[model samples]
Target chain A: MSETWKAFKPYALITPQTLVFLLFLVFPIVMIGVVSFWEFNGYSMTPAFTLANYQGIFTDVTLKTYLNTFKFLGLVWVATLLIGYPVAYFLAFHVPKLEWQILLFLVCTIPFWTSNIIRMISWVPLLGREGLVNQILMGIGLTQQPLEFLLYSDFAVVLGMVHLYIIFMIAPIFNSLMRIERSLITAAEDLGASGVQIFKEVILPLSAPGIAIGSIFIVTLVMGEFVTVRLMGGGQSASVGKLIQTQIGSLQYPLAAANAIVLLAVTMLIIVSILRVLDIRKEL
Target chain B: MQKRALSFYLLLAFFCLFVLFLYGPMITIFMLSLQGPDGALTFPMRGLSFYWLGQVFQEQRVGNFIEPFVRSLLLGATVMAITITASVLASMGFRQRFKGSTVIFYMTIASLIVPSILVSLGIGVVFQVMGWPTNWFSSGLGAHLTWTLPIAFLIMLGIFNRFDPSYEEAARDLGATDPKTFWEIVLPLIAPSLLGVGLLTFTLSYDEFTRTSLVSGQNNTLPLEIFGMTTNVTSPALYALGTLTTIFSASLILIAYFAYTAVVKRQRGKA
Candidate 1:
């Protein structure tokens, strides 16, 4: 082959990916940014640029939606970490056999392969007013009436989000934990480090990357979430995603695009800050 | 070290509860799905039967389940093929030190972290602006690719990282041409990772909803159909559909696991 052909081989090979990425990923985001500045009338969108969409973000509804989204993000993040960390810790430290570790990890991951929507809705039967939990509570005479707030409330929304996203937390944390050399812990103990001391000084710092990655996943997903909040909150709650969806449904494309761009910017900022803290490229 | 610690048992109990928390709702839905035709959505099954599962097929309220199921499968397979091919080629390009490699790599990561709804909306708007009606095979495929290709690229990076260049160099030293060496040596070595990537991309594409929702145009995928039914259809038939899709996904995972293990075992035995 000629020198030019040799040099061009990699670019030629990458053309398909580049084309797909540019057309689908980069171009669409650019389009969103462009469309956000465009004008939208009641019936149709126009090409005129304006800041009206950005101004729309200052409304009480938008403020509440963002606050609600952040609230969900904080709640789900802490819940998933509490649940996920211990599970990942147990698997990484306590599991005596490699096969058993793999088995348990796979068990946790199986549900993740299924539809998240199905999994979210599955909570309806368990948390509904006449559902199993309420039935059991009443059956045990624990309450006079079924808990009305069990379903279609903030609690249910958090529960559903945590259920769907906890595995994302576990997988990354488990990976980071597994990567910690056994000898490091052994050395810590040999140097008279207590269990908690070893964990705090050694294990925790090393797992920071995993926690950061998991947080990125949970935070971004929660920030942009619509379906879970809509379904579990029973339309009682609104999220930025839901707000954008409403705009889109109403054919307010420019306004929705603007909301979406803001959402994207916020999510990206969170992710970038996390990436900065951890520099997870090495871990990846 | 051989003796079990007290903390181990506590952790084990916690792990068991977590597992139950994860699988409990699924099992509940599975049982509810077997409820008799007269039964409602909640527990205490009026009678145990496959009536609702049957209803999933016979009922029109489920919104063309069969066609959408088939469409999702076709789309999954197509996306799987494209993702594998594109990722393999891209990973090859990535192996070399190129001028724009970081740009491409970051773009893939950006594709992943960007919200799916935004991507869907943007693509939908783009299609609308161009007077092109978004369809499953074209625009929907493009949308799915935006998600799957990034994941596929990352998997390929891991695969290629572990790949030894010495083997390819040895093949070239033995007078094999570049294409011939890649086909005979490199391809075989990476076949397992390719299979793994294929499985990953397929499952991701199969269960995909948010990205597909806007670009899917008139036709619904299985998840989209189920999402629609959640609003109107309040019955065990919904659970039946969930049970069925879970079964499909579980079986795919099982088959892939077994195939992967068999290949590993055979390779180990030969070595």
Candidate 2:
């Protein structure tokens, strides 16, 4: 009895967290399923249930909006992977010293500290018509006039998102790459495996879990993307996030909730699909 | 040898360029803050005046930006406190076994993977309904608590998983009460995690744009203010605020690094 009392004492100390989690997190998610059915007007929510919001999203226009948002997100997702892969590869395999790796990694994380909004906005002066790039280009006689197509375009939106999220992609990929046994790479070379073949056959496959983690991180955030698309895409882009925001602004809670629920469904589907494919438990 | 050296040099060059890409826009914003609103990229920049920076401080219109900023900070601080407290307890509780503990643990895991936006929307809708039925409770703290609890649970879970239960057990054996053992032995050991998780929660809370945008009725946080300002193209003063915000944001990352190092070091020593 005393022995069990000893364990019980420690267990009791940690119960508050379990209680709070139940009260806040687990409870609200349960409520979301409930709220999705209820008709929410701005001021007061009606208890009446409807699945019309889900049905509405399947219409051609709304589906097209989702397609466009995914298309953009996918492009940025690929770009972040392509760019971040080399940085992680170099950091893990190429960097000679541990201190340099940490220093370089810290430098990569510095910009992320700034609000993503500021990071997106900062590009305006650099990419704007009379911005630094154009001024420099014109000064060097590379162009006759400021490039009007530079800022507030899909190009800028993709560029800014890639720049902001590439770090998120790199960190996980690096963690996986660092776990690779050094002698294994050397042995591949010793066995007459070419550098490219070793990467293709060994390094790339080994790092898939990290890539999956990073991709999900980027893609899920990208799915609910508002800041980059709004600021850089000039609000002309009606992203799922922006669409939900518009509804919320006017107090269209039911419609907004409906839209948000759709986004949530799509995002959860992607994460589940990725987790299934990666089977990350084995890697961990 | 030359080939090896060349590849090393190439990697260094790429790292330098990559770091530049990460930081270049921020440096540009810093520079632009000092420039006049004539949309000129002139080198002199009207002799580097703080005219726009001053405008952010003294102008009443600046309230639009400052309100959100202050609100974000407040939200961040409050969320930090809640997350640290809750996560630490969860971490401790997590160290023990009970009925449905695995289910509870998996629930925490699920929350971590579930998209923040999804969770935010779900909670935001629920809070609105629950809060609408009440004048005193629903709107303010209730809304924030919904998001804060999930994140704090996840972070505290990660921390507690890494912690050894022996120390706490020993303290309890020596006649410490449950709360006293947590406060004296367990809490001190996990202090760094609390700080790290607290900082991350604060950053996530402060920079939380989408969820706060949905949930905040009349209350504007820093992100919402920036959102509003960006829409109004007339104001270049937002650029100044961006510059200032950039400087302030670095502290979160610094806190994160210190906390991570402390945690990692402790883990290594134990191993």
Whole-model Cα lDDT of every candidate shown, in order: 0.88, 0.72
TM-score of candidate 2 restricted to chain B? 0.79
CA RMSD for every model?
1.6, 3.7
Residue B159 in candidate 2, Cα distance off native in Å: 4.4
lDDT of 2 by residue, A1-284 (tens): 37877567545755665665565566766666666677755565687788865787788978888998898888999889888988898888887799888887787877765688888888887887778888899999999998877788778878988987898899889989999988889899899987678989999889999998898888777887777887898856657876766766676667766777678788878888988888677544
Question: Residue A283: error of model 2 in Å?
Answer: 4.3
Each predicted complex: what DockQ?
0.79, 0.47
Estimate candidate 2's alpha-carbon lDDT, on a 0 to 1 scale.
Answer: 0.72
For model 1, residues A18-104, the per-residue Cα lDDT tens digits are 899899988887888888999887888888889999999999989888988889998999999999999999999999899999999
The estimated TM-scores of all candidates read 0.97, 0.87
Ten-residue stretch with the least lDDT total in model 1 chain A:
A275-284
Interface root mean square deviation for model 2, in Å? 3.1
